[model samples]
Target: MPALPRPATGPGSRYTARAATTRTRPTPARAKPDIVALARRLTARDLWLTALIHEHRVLTAQQITRLAFTSTRSAQRRLRTLHHYGVLDSFRPLTVSGSAPEHYTLGPAGAQLLAAQAARDMTDTLWRPTSTGRIAYSPWLGHDTGVNELLTHLAAHTRHHPHTRLPLWLSENSCARRWGDIIRPDAYAHWTETTPHGERLLPFFLEYDTGSQTLARVEAKLPGYAAFTTATGTAPALLIHTRTASRELALRRRLTDPARDLGLRLATASLDQTTDTPHARWWMPLEPTAGRLTLTGLAVRWHPLTPATGLEATDADTPLTLPVPPLPPAPHTAP
Candidate 1:
């Protein structure tokens, strides 16, 4: 028999595990879309959506609506338009349930336009024609969508509420780039809540769990976070969002010993437990029973934690030469 080829391996193998196992959908042979025309037709919001899709790898129609649009129907209408224009591509995963929401990724013309706006060559953008297909077929698609869902809810809250802001939201890739040595959180964020006295800031590392990994594997992540705190002299409260209430209980039980030993500020919330929004009193501390607390309440509870330094643009050790602003651009107003 002929020898089989070795699988691709590198520093990024952990992130690309699904790539080797899953086959990308074949692209149909068709004429390339008019990139220049699409670029000219792109609006501020359209460009922002393209950039966001590029950054996060994938977003569901519902998530995009929560992040930008005013209504589900309108968002769907606009998304259809964009998808038809070859500016966005989408896939609906087959679920045991009736149907799944459409998930969106940057299309070919969108990638070219985005790269052009950034004054970079197509090769530098790291986007390929098959990128969307890879995302669609990956097992991690649901987990990624869940991560975006939580953050988008928080970001969208600012629209209706006054004096609340999501100042910073770093994706898994961004978090890894910044703090990969000691610990790489699924997401790192800053939420500012207004108090009568002044403003209170909540900096947290999010671990969105789908209950796929073993409890041991989940509990094993604590020491790295502790080491990070010790090394940086800054502690960000860790919030684990679980799929079910039972899973949250299991994790809390599994993690309590080490989390206490390491003196890590940890909390867990489950999807079933949160009735209103993520901002509601859903998060429960890993410690003894009291009651659920809001995200801001967790901030107040973990007062000892400090905002991470070197994250600002003026800081010397900042990761990106120019950090991406957390919020998208405001709608252009007619003067």
Candidate 2:
């Protein structure tokens, strides 16, 4: 087993922008709203979305809808209301073809509420008035949103499928807090499917690529994951989602030897191949001539992979907290 490498945290995953021009909305200038009043009026989904934005840093309006709402209009209307109330802040990045959807981040009131819920100060949430501006102009905005979209789609899929649940979805920052020393995956997730036979769990580290990095740079990250598996004594599958079919193919060719040599269970998928219902058979194993497999199918293909640990309730009390619980609190029913 290889020794764990020194903590080599890279820049946040780059969501490369294609636009030469960007239009950023001015930061909100209103005084901080009453946290008590805001907290009392927030809906179940509102609080959940707030915490999610704080956890993930940013999510586009469409991504939010997939995770929380039934319709685009309703999601937009409610998100606008949240923005007006200072519970959420949003900005749109301009693109060559058209304007991008609104990207949301935690606002002052939302930060206060989340901190109060966690029994901490607002600073503990790491939010500043300029947080939205920072995220809006981030070079990696596209990459972050891309990574988020994949999980949001999966979450949406589970909403209509009674037999499945996405029990865990941790953003890159959360993964860094736990495993930054050895590896920095774009995101981490735990999924489960309950069938007649039994419950199957698929816990994975997501590497979302935008084709900005060279194939060698991409394959270079494998050793870190290898060391992480050795250090933790757990081997979570590494699922790499590429931006194009050609890139995916080239990457699989480049990574096959290194991944196999490290005894890593890895899979590849392309954005072009994944539909809204992402659980379909889109993922191809790194091995040659292997047919594409569904998300859960990959789990079964690599049986006896160690279940994700250190995410127990007791682990959340540290200075670095656990990721927000995957599912939102149940909607409040009228008494």
Candidate 3:
């Protein structure tokens, strides 16, 4: 007669008394938060975060925390706020172990904000970020981020250690402006490490290698470095960071080739050496006679790098500044 309707066996159907189950509830991701509402809530601190992302071009979540925030938890909340309001954009690379770190780049709203701060037309400059920001996804992102990792490590170390300071941290682009024709070190920095004896300035040209280039290609850059040192009369140490132990060994051999007879002092180390506690990292001098040198001890290991000029010579190529110890933190008062 009227056949009974088929039993609904699907999970949502009323086929059984049982209900679907999950171990735990997961937080849902925000696809796109209310842009206008979030825009109205932007704070001065948020603007500073945008400026930082703009200046660095690319920074990991951890790096951002180091740059601005006191804790990762707070950094996450703030980054989410900026991302929702379109002032910051982020991407994570695929990884084998654990989750990937979210790397941030300045977004359209950040560009507009910067333009407005400078009293410039947003139409032209605001759109510039799209052209500039896509670099976070470029193939070289790994290498670029690796280079920046070294910088962030040094900056963080400087913050904690009283005896050390990173006074001048210049990006590769800034180095290009300063020494473009001669040689552009991936970066240029003045490291001042104090001891009971005295503070020493360890200024060096950083060459962060990702092991993508052949040893031959690496050697090709040596002559430029040698020439730059000779011209400046300030022997800025040429510091090379390789991706692996084998890569470091290969690079060290290239640095030792007497046939090249490079006048510059070369130091080689693997990425593992500098990832954490950068101050503890060792840079093995190309000279077999010299042992691996710690970050603070570079002055003793590479004495030649220090300008020979007398203290009266203010015209020194790169003037070293006195160490500035971190100021004591303010006392917390009861709320």
lDDT of 1 by residue, 1-335 (tens): 11112212210111232232122323531357677777666677887778778777788888888777878988888887777777788776655434566778878777777767767777656778778778866767767877888888888898778689897888888777677887878888898889896787889999988776788888889999899888889988999998777778788888988899999999999878763399889998888774799988888887756876546555433222234444557864211
Better of 1 and 2 by TM-score: 2
Question: What is the alpha-carbon lDDT for the whole of candidate 2?
Answer: 0.77
Looking at candidate 2, what is the lDDT of residue 115? 83
Best by lDDT: 2
Order candidates by TM-score, high to low. 2, 1, 3
TM-score of each: 0.85, 0.88, 0.74
Once fitted onto the true fold, the runs of candidate 3 whose alpha carbons sit more than 4 angstroms away are: 1-48, 96-98, 119-129, 258-260, 304-335
Clashes of each: 0, 3, 0
**In model 3, how large is the Cα lDDT of residue 78?**
77
The local lDDT score (0 to 100) that residue 232 gets in candidate 3 is 68
- Candidate 1, after superposition: displacement of residue 270 in Å? 0.6
Compare the candidates by TM-score and give the number of the best one.
2
Please write out the lDDT profile of model 2 over residues 97-135, one tens digit for every residue.
434677788887788888888788888889887788778
